[model samples]
Target: MQHLSVARPARAILLGSAGLLLSGCSLFQSSAPQAPLPASATLPDATISYTLTGQGSMPVVFQSDLGDGKDAWDSVLPLAEQQYRVLAYDRPGYGASRKTATPRDPCTIAAQQHAMLAQAGVKPPYVLVGHGMGGLYQYVYARLYPQEVAGLVLLDPTHPDHWRRMQSDAPTSAMAIKARRKLMFTSIETVEFDAQAQCLQHIDLKTPLRMPTMLLVRDKFGIEELGSVETLVRSQEKDWQRMTGAPAIERITGAGHYIQKDNPVIVNEAIKMVVKKK
Candidate 1:
């Protein structure tokens, strides 16, 4: 299997304790750190250390962006736990979880995570939440195993189309992608990239996941330049329309690439709505 290589920068939310402030995801930690491990009943690969808070039937499994671990959604968990069972963990190789030698492509990651969830006895009727790169994984997961997934929440996910577009004609743009990849590697380790396998695999959500999908996103790129917020909004608006189609989409104000940290309330509400849906 071809390995995937990606570099994600470390993002942390910094503000006084007044308003709700979500923390950065902890991407790197040695096995020596002695973090709390998942229940022993989980599969060997799923034996990741994570914080599980909340209560409910439809368990919400949150996947963090490149390198980020469970802490990424610290603030939001309190509220989320109040309604649904919130489960977030470090993907293999990043946090306290055991690293894997296999490629970290969408299918591989999704399958492995699914296995882990099963081993841990976290049954489906699940509400999957993914931030940034995590969003991409959840998308693939729903496509691969739609019956298990109940809903999806994507927080400013990186568009696979955008990456492909940059790689084709824009050498300069590709450089930016490369730079981001480098940053991701430095912050975390043992990640793989299979460009061939991951290049927009005909995701027709119209099939299995008739469930609600809430995309709480910020404009990552617009036209040529990073573009103004307006441009980003318009650009995201078009993509959002195409992506969600029948599903509802909400555009939150004042959020950046990391929508969860930007405003936990928005993230919480989006997850709440999707999980609450009958």
Candidate 2:
């Protein structure tokens, strides 16, 4: 099923699995000025920018995981924004958004995201698409406001087990730690991480998610000698299948941790399917 392109060893450091490394794609950075947002919605002081496009019955809000902001999704947002009333915003401390006391971890980050969406006048019955760390917030969002999410699309998301196993000396934990250290070193600053880690500490994975969701995992096989990409994908596949309790899963071929960069077509298709379903 992996019928796409682009794969290079990520020298910039990885944050999850050692086998999950990828060639980081740079699109829009937080420093760039975004295109004008839809007039119907406005960017508050807490966010760098919030754009709402599309006029569908249900709204799709895009949230960046690392607080890198909506600019990171420059390539993909317009496509989705045209179809649904899509909303994308930069969380505090990253883009034009104000640096607030809010933490970027699961529980507090989830609450902040929900509150921001509500304040922006974007509400429940939404189709949420999150990538990487954003996947964690999406999970927390769905759990916190189950009634608000209509469909979910997770692109190689981060799971609590991914971190827990890393610290537990499990076969997968070491790689997860390496990935995190690499990523944390490259993207997150020391001060930012202190706040981020504090918020992440309170998240308990015992909460079960019941929303209809699709997890698009990069199927990396033998990309690195540390572990077989096949084994990595299978392990994550089992975890996601159990976590979401959804029988449907898509194995994106020839992709690493960043599936969104590997192939946006898969993500677009998956989101459309979930949103279009009756």
Cα error, residue 85 of model 2, in Å, equals: 1.0
For each candidate in turn, give its C-alpha RMSD to the true structure in angstroms: 9.2, 5.6
Enumerate residue pairs that collide in model 2: 2-253, 14-179, 15-179, 15-180, 47-97, 48-97, 65-134, 166-173, 220-229, 222-229
Tell me the spans in candidate 2 whose CA falls farther than 4 Å from its real position.
Answer: 1-13, 16-48, 170-208, 221-225, 228-233
What's the lDDT for all of these models?
0.59, 0.59
Cα distance off (Å), candidate 1, residue 158: 1.9
What is the C-alpha RMSD, rounded to one decimal, of candidate 2? 5.6
- Flag clash pairs in model 1: 3-193, 4-192, 4-193, 5-193, 7-181, 7-184, 8-184, 54-81
Backbone clash tally (model 1): 8
Per-residue alpha-carbon lDDT of candidate 1 for residues 65-118, written as tens digits (9 for 90 to 100): 765677777656766776777688877766677665556777777888888777
Error of 2 at 63 (Å): 2.4
